[model samples]
Target: MSHHLASLMVAGGLDALTYSSLAFLIASGLTVVFGMLGFLNVAHTSFYMLAGYIGFSIASRTGSFWLALLLAPPVTVALGLAAERLLFRRLYAAGHTPQLLLTIGLAYVIAETTKMIWGDDSLALAPPTGLGGHVVILGATLPVYHLFVIVITMALVGLLALLIGWTRLGMVVRAAAIHPQMVDALGFKLSAVHTFVFLVGLYLAAVAGVVMAPMLGIYPGMADDALVQSFIVVVAGGLGSLPGAFVVAGLLGLVQGFGSVFLSDYALYFPFVVLAGVLLVRPLGLFGRGGA
Candidate 1:
């Protein structure tokens, strides 16, 4: 292996773009629920972690990453809907503190349940047939899977932007976020909208885990790592701003990716440094209306 500083930096940039996309997928769910629903659900990352494990299992048993990718999101979405009816619905009026506690406890439960099912070992899956290769970029080797992840996530961003920005359903979602009571008073069932949004969030998390399962591996501790990233993205992007989530995700991804290559010894701390700097410069985050 030879060191090429410029090629290394480009590699880092590709890594950043891929990572930021995955983070955005996971964090978007958290931001949507927190920003639009006005309640913090810390257990969201559990869905992401669980999806990776589940998708891995499916791929292992069936030898088909395609099936795993298709099946995982719906399964996770179903679980989210169940949580809404059986657990989260009760917490709607309990405010953030109780919601936080309940979700924290739920996160533990999900983690433990995952342990019982998957054991404590970390698991990896092979990328889908077409994605398992390498591509050359700027005199450096880039994983084809990384570029694939970026394209899929970008497609998702476009789909979400269109759905939330133009559709009637999106109008209802925005209305619910801004004024739930008014939406309910206007003859639309707000609970359904809430359930839909929550499921969308969970689905997104599952999709992220499924797509990145090969890169990130599967383990019980994955949820905690994801939660930390989610918190940063949510805080940095501003609460309730999906567009902000996209920007912040990309920013943090680049910061961490390049920071690791340039400051390898301090790579672990670089992300937090970026977060702190962003906070100091604008406590409200880049697009947030106010600090959390």
Candidate 2:
């Protein structure tokens, strides 16, 4: 291949990696919450989109990215808590179809609420001053914002790993994931633990939104596609497996990123193809255990 062709290929590969990181960021939270709580949070993507809108609003009004970064997640956490307490708690004993229907209804409610509040116009978030330019790497120029996003995502993933592996709360979460009945038997409040897990998932989704807003341009239905994509990641990675979600998210992101270049309009369906194949081969998912 010509030197220029080689450079373009390398750049495309890096871009794919960048995209995968975003997918991982979005998917990890969904995987953790779903895996631990055994509840499919169909409204999770709304939290993601709400984060972007919240962050954008704050940043635009105050011109302080730091404030937006700090504020959005907590707001999302509160929302998650409200949903869990008011809606999800009732659905815990309900059948899967009812639980799913409730969540799906909640998703529509959130989307419509967002539209009512933010309008249908697309909104763009300005990158922080430090990440507002471009950087050249390996004879290719890439957006500094995207590089920052990749770094932040890696740090978030590492932090999540540490939280799950080292902290007391993490221990409870892990225990709940592995043996919820046992955890409750041991005197831990299952409701409290699930609430915490749900909040954490919402926070993660919010962070993903804040980071993605600059790239995706926040809009009313911004999270519609993301909801489906996250489901694909969760199922592909094996439901409830945090590490599996990361691996599958990365794979899907890479496939979509590179496939889009070649397949153009059809790239959106690439992850589904991989998902179908994986399900056929291993119905349990890449890392999902048959139970728990």
Candidate 3:
């Protein structure tokens, strides 16, 4: 390829990776909750948006991005835990419709409350010190913060793999995902496991929100866009498959990044098209199985 073409390709590739990283972070939680708990949380992205606003507030007050990073996720987790304990716990046996409706209502509440508190204007959160510069990659200038996001995502992926593959909690979670009754019969606390998994999912979303705030900005309807993209990733990857979500997120990122350049007018529909194509070929998704 010519130098210009090569640079464009490199830039697009980097953009794709960054997008994939963010999607994975957001979708992994959604997948995990669905896989393990069988509960669909339509309000998950609202938690993400809420955490971003909280992080912004914390950073603004403390003048410490590090502090916001440290604290915002826990606050998100607290709210998630409250929702699980107070609302979701009572509805586990009520089926999907009620849960879906409840979550939708929760999303609206969060959106309106956020607007009331923070106003409707978009807010910017700067990257941490030393991450605001540009770096040259194959003659392509890229934001250092984008690279940081990619690296952090990779680290979190490894951490998740280790958490889900090797530990005792992981074993119990895996068992519960497939057969909660059997796990419960074996003396594991299903309720506790469900709560933990739900909180973990929220924690992941909060991390993505805080980390991605610099790139995406905090806005009133930010959660809507994220929710749409995340739902696409989850459904396209398979309802409850983390590995599938990761792969699909990468595929989606590439489609979006390049599509925006080459098919600007139609780029908005590209993800839905990819989702449709994937479902048409493999109804169960790329890596989906009968259970978690």
Candidate 4:
């Protein structure tokens, strides 16, 4: 292989990794919320977008990306909790229609509120002082912030695995996802479990938003594109399946990154094509359960 080709491949791979990292961050939360609640949170990406805007505000005022990162997720998660307590909790047994309508309305309201506060103009956020540099790998220049994203995502994946696999809360969450009535029968508060799961899921999205702010910038319509991409990931990976989300996220990222180079004219359509193919083969999704 030629040196230049190797460099190009490395660059593409890194870009794919970065994209996959972001997708997984968003989709993981969405899937978890769906898994526990048995309904998709349509406003999930709106929370993600909201976090970016909030993070930008903090960073701008405090002049510290780290501060924004530390503070933004909790703020976003608080709003999610508020929505859950006041709005979503009422719709738990109301079926998909009510849940869908409520969430979509919430999404629109959040979007409009963000525009009112931040305006429609896009805003750029610079990386932290230390992460502003780049390193050469396989003769390709790789940004340190991208590396930071990949590393942080991997760490979170490990943390999530431990949380879901070994912790009592995780066990309760899994049980609730499969058999809510039985969980309620066991003297556990099903509603509390649902609320906690939602909190964790939204926190993940908030973290993703703050982390991605530097890379993607803050904008009004950002959540819509993110929503589409993340829905594709959740559906393809199997709703509520973290491993499925992770695998499909990597695959979609590679498709987008390489497609942009090899099939530039139709690159934008490639993800939807992948989604169509997945649905044709596995209507329930690659990792989704029988009913889901």
Q: Tell me, by lDDT, which candidate is best.
A: 4
lDDT of 1: 0.87
lDDT of 4 at 25: 89
Model 4 clash pairs?
A: none
TM-scores of all predicted structures:
0.95, 0.93, 0.95, 0.95
For model 3 the TM-score comes to: 0.95
Candidate 2 clashes: the total is 1
lDDT of 2 by residue, 1-292 (tens): 5876666766677678777887776777778777766677788898889889889889999998878988987887788788888899998777678888998999899898888888989999888888889877777777888778778888887887898899998898889888989999999998888888778778877988888887888988768788878888888889788778878877786777677666768987788997997888889899977863
Which TM-score value belongs to model 1? Answer: 0.95
lDDT of 1 at 215: 87
For model 1 the local lDDT of residue 217 reads 82
Instruction: Tell me the deviation in Å of residue 245 in model 3.
Output: 0.9
| Candidate 1 per-residue C-alpha lDDT over 104-192 given as tens digits, one digit per residue, 9 for 90 to 100 | 99899989999999899988899999899998877889999999999988898889889989999999988898898999999999889
Error of 1 at 235 (Å): 1.7
Better of 2 and 4 by lDDT: 4
> Ranking under lDDT, best-scoring first?
4, 3, 1, 2
Give candidate 1 regions above 4 Å deviation.
1-5
